[model samples]
Target: MISAQNIIKTYGNKTKKTQILNNISLTIADRSFTVILGASGSGKSTLLNILSGLERPDSGSIRYADTDITFLSDSQLTEFRKEKIGFVFQQYYLLPNMTAEQNIRMGADLAGNPDYRETIRAVGLENERKKYPDELSGGEQQRVSIARALAKKPDFLFLDEPTGALDEKTGRQILAYIADIHQRCGVTMILVTHNQNIAEMADTVIRMNSGRIETEQKNQTKKTAYEIAW
Candidate 1:
């Protein structure tokens, strides 16, 4: 039940304000998969950060379940981020020194939760758990990142170009992994991708242009199984 109503976010001062978002409103249904599609610099990241409580809106309301996150103190936002949200970035932000297993465990440990060994195995990385980031391939690194995020058992997951660094074949496999995690975990997911091919696979595709949602499309006829379930 994450709904952002008429969310507005601007950067800079009044005299020279850059409107990053303009009256944007969207909702992430419980256990739904969504894709936010936009070109570079079209406010995609800004919108994602706002929803995840990493940034605040200038003139808008954001609600996650029962809490209104508009003016939450910095400390409160930090706690909320740690407890509620999981992030997967394009770069696969894993520590250089930590093994894949250690990194995955660390993410949950920070949030005061149990390490999710099953998710690690689900990502097909149980054998590589002892390997560090530098030792793994691009796709494997992404899997570790995904496993780490899922280890948090977050209420929602935000993935920014989850497959950006991998080859085409590897990217598709990564997407399948994401689909599997989403399905098995029953976690709400919002993926931001510049690839239109991937966007079409989402349950709902939110097209954006210049900081505004151009249109939204839903594929009611497409079976959920067709959505990249690996």
Candidate 2:
């Protein structure tokens, strides 16, 4: 379980400080799909960064099981994230010169996961393995990015608007792949997005407003990616 207590994050100096998260506390169950839903400037992204250890909270404790990551130094946190977390963002961030398979191999190499080809098959990118990022479609690029992250075999996968750059049809397809992978691998997936429809697919939906959590609901019946209205 990932537990966060009184998370308070602010930006800028004292004279111009802008609080991004305010006394937020939440718990994410292991192997569960979670969605943090909010509008622009609602602090959802900032909260995700803190929870995933990409950023430190000004005053709070973030614990992954029994380990309190908040106390870890910069280098320690870097190693921690390298070992335990995988991230997929709106941007593909793939090396232009590298083929899809090679890009995925970069992450797999980090954890010495030799069975990385399984991840390519998991994301349905088997045929596109040799294709460069420029040759692939937006949706395909995103799939490669997801596969790269998953190849690392991280316990937690943090996705920041994974489908933000894709069209409706492509987004649905990507979400389906993600859903399937989560079910098969049992990885803890935390997705941050502004779309309310996406929340229907998650086990837990957290709504944020301004700098606070407005509500956190557990869906009694989670909807599949295709079942949600785009």
Candidate 3:
């Protein structure tokens, strides 16, 4: 479980501080699909960064199970993230010159996963392993990025607008791939997006407004990617 309490975050200099997260307290269940929903500047992304140990809160604590990561050193945080976390974002972030297989290998190598080919197949990119990023379409590149992240076998998968750059049809396809991976791996998947439609696929939904959590609810019957409206 990931627990956060009284979390507060601010930006800017001391003379012009702007609060981004206000006294947020929440717990993310283990091996569950969670969606953090909010508009732009609602602090959804900031909260995801803090919870994933990418950023530290100005006040309060963020605990990944029993360890309080808030006090960890930069090196410690890097090591922790490398070992336990996987990320998929709006940007594909694949190397321009590297082949899809090489890009996926970069992540798999971190965790010594020799059978990383399975991840390429899982994302339906087995046939395009030799293709470079420039040779693939946006959706296919995103698939390679997702495959790379999963190849590390991370315990927590953080996705920030995974389909923000894709068309509706491609977005649905990516979401379906993510849903399938989540079900098969049972990793704790935390996704942050402004799209309310995406929340229906989550086991838990957290709504945020103006830097604070407005509501948090458990879905009685979560919908699949195909069932979600575009």
Residue range 1-230, candidate 3, lDDT tens digits = 99999999999996899999999999999999999999999999999989888889999998898888998899999998988899887888999889999999999999889988888888888889999999999999999999888999999999989998999989999999999888989999999999999999999999999999999999999887789888
Q: What lDDT would each prediction earn against the true structure?
A: 0.86, 0.94, 0.93
lDDT score, candidate 1, position 178: 82
Candidate 3 — worst ten consecutive residues by lDDT sum? 115-124
Model 3, position 20, has a per-residue lDDT of 99
Candidate 2 lDDT over residue span 71-91, tens digit each = 999999999988999999888
| Winner of 2 and 3 under TM-score | 2
lDDT for position 84 in model 3? 89
Residue 8, candidate 2: Cα error in Å is 0.9
The sequence of per-residue lDDT tens digits that candidate 1 reaches over residues 85-161 is: 99998999899999999999988787777756877877899899999999999999999998888888898999998
Ranking by TM-score: 2, 3, 1
Question: Candidate 1: minimum summed lDDT over ten consecutive residues — where?
Answer: 221-230
Q: To one decimal, what is the Cα RMSD in angstroms of model 1 from the true structure? A: 2.5
Tell how far residue 81 is off in model 3, in angstroms: 0.4
